[model samples]
Target: MDMMMVIYNGLLSDEYIKGQATGRIKFYEYPPTGDISGPYIVIDPLGPPQSADYGDNIPIKDDYLYQIDVWTKNRLVTKELSKRVQKVMRSIGFGYFAGGVDEYDKDTGIYRDARRYRGKAYTEEFEI
Candidate 1:
């Protein structure tokens, strides 16, 4: 449930900023926050310095945090794709992603109360 998307590069349209124009800016939810960083464009106090010690660098935030760099063209076949993604998450009882709790319910079949989803005892199985 973490499917997000954002891609705007229409020639960098002068970094529009008139009431937060969003004619089509998919997802720049605002992130840049001072001190220069990398990759988020729109900060050229006079454009030029981008090396000799973080010169033209201005992107500590302007929204661009996509994180997920799991590379593997065949790094030992990624341990067989991580054991086939935990063997399809154990045939449908997903036992990981504990950022919440034992959760997985393709409609109703594996939910060790990830904080009881929304209550009503949540479905999938977790009756204790």
Candidate 2:
């Protein structure tokens, strides 16, 4: 399953809209080039997927771990964005159990809060 697409769609869902008063925000799969404004989210896979036991080697279920970074000029805004992201991911069936402010870049004046979520997609049946 395309986990990034799932996350992107969830952020644009109605639930996210009603949860915050923030204006139009940008979302990127990876870091973007050129000048950009505050209040944007970046979704990136942390690393390669680790093996989860697949009974009978059918591969009916897949789990991926990813990182969602919320960046903004204001610390409070960053935190709020992170919370909304967590809610959205949860709504989309992702299990988000760990996250926190990873770092603050003084050079760019951006506060980034990173969240880790495990997304699992399963099929009822799969042919070998």
Candidate 3:
């Protein structure tokens, strides 16, 4: 299954995320060119899914790592969204790996809050 799609759908499925930033999530290395603009999010895979568990010579569970960047107009919004994002991800079985690297984009005047999560699960458990 597509892991990034799963993460994107997981975020999209949350009520807070739905109401706060519907259709504002992007799954790519670069944010789209002025596409719907800032106050959006970007999800990037940090590494390929690796086999975590095996039984009888078969892989039963896989591990995944992804970085989610929250972009907004100010620090308060970024922090609030980052908290909601962390909660939503944990609810979906992902655990926080790193986070809260807040920065300001001089060019766009947008605040970026970067966070990472790691999860290990059976491939079927991720079905959305």
Report every candidate's CA lDDT. Answer: 0.24, 0.67, 0.79
What's the CA error at residue 122 for candidate 2, in Å? Answer: 1.4
| Model 1, C-alpha of 6: deviation from truth (Å) | 27
lDDT of 1 by residue, 1-128 (tens): 11122112221222322113233222323222331121221211112212221214532212112211111223333333233333333343333332332223344222222111110111212223
**Alpha-carbon shift of residue 74 in model 2 (angstroms):** 0.9
Candidate 3 stretches greater than 4 Å from native? 32-38, 124-128
- Listed in order, each prediction's TM-score against the native is 0.17, 0.71, 0.81
Q: Rate residue 9 of model 1 by lDDT.
A: 29
| Highest-scoring model, lDDT | 3
Choose the strongest candidate by TM-score. 3
**TM-score of decoy 3:** 0.81
Off by over 4 Å in 2: 14-36, 48-56, 97-100, 123-128
Positional deviation of residue 128's Cα in model 3 after best superposition, in angstroms: 13
Candidate 1 clash pair list: 31-61, 31-62, 31-63, 32-61, 32-62, 49-55, 49-56, 50-56, 109-124
lDDT of 2 by residue, 8-108 (tens): 76787745433442344334443443233646677777766555548787566667787877776778877877888888888877777575556777777
Across 37-72, the per-residue lDDT of candidate 3 in tens digits comes to: 546888988889998777777778889998998887
